[model samples]
Target: MKILKLEIKQKPFDDILSGKKYFERREIKPSNVIDYVSFIVDGKEYEKEEDVPEGDSEVMVKAKSYDRLKLVTGEYKGKRPYLMVEVKDAHVEFLYDENGDFIVGVEKGKEYAIAHIVFELGNVVEIFKGEK
Candidate 1:
């Protein structure tokens, strides 16, 4: 399955392990934001090969987003905690400014720093005891 590996911290990790946290948040950065699995804009083809089309619009990321999410935490009690969760669905939200509007920056009419991808976590399929 397609897995998205993420490094998590202690506090949140404990919450997730205890089933207190239900969702995981990750910002859409260049290193992670690549070609879309399948997304359209304004009822038109948004070009899957391209990152995003020019205009003020939003699209839902699907399929290739990831079938599973791998969360890893650094050394804790001489062991790194690692958890693999099934990603049921993912939601994408465009960032806004102080005025609470979508921030579509300049660089070829793209928004690199203005989007958030939240993973709706499902069951914890696997848990691995990481090395110290």
Candidate 2:
């Protein structure tokens, strides 16, 4: 079968890395999984907590903290698929602020919201606005 690949942009710490450039593409499989080659399974210290939004029971993750994300085998549309990822453990830790709620990590009074998304291939897609 033909492989479908999805292209997503990634931004890393500029100072820590050599240079910022376009990230690689993950090979998509019939199962809807996209296997990424950039990430590695380095068992690191990760954290996990319940991310309960107001009046919500879907406990999505909040943050990955300082852990290396893992890439696990998952199913996509009933087929074994892969995904390009950042955090790939069975569960991830969410970064919290003093209030105990999931922090957006943006400066106060900002007009943006932080969102954490988990894709089918065990990737934590984090969208942050502004600086912490």
Global lDDT scores for all candidate models: 0.71, 0.29
Return the TM-score for candidate 1, rounded to 2 decimals: 0.68
**Pairs clashing within candidate 1:** none
Backbone clash count for every predicted candidate, in the order shown: 0, 11
Cα lDDT over the full model 1 = 0.71
lDDT of 2 by residue, 50-90 (tens): 12223423332222222333222332335333332342232
Residue 16, candidate 2: Cα error in Å is 15
Q: Runs in model 2 with CA error above 4 Å?
A: 1-90, 105-132
lDDT string, candidate 1, 54-123, tens digits: 7688755543468888898886567677898988888777788999877764455544546667788888
- Candidate 2, residue 7: Cα displacement in angstroms equals 6.5
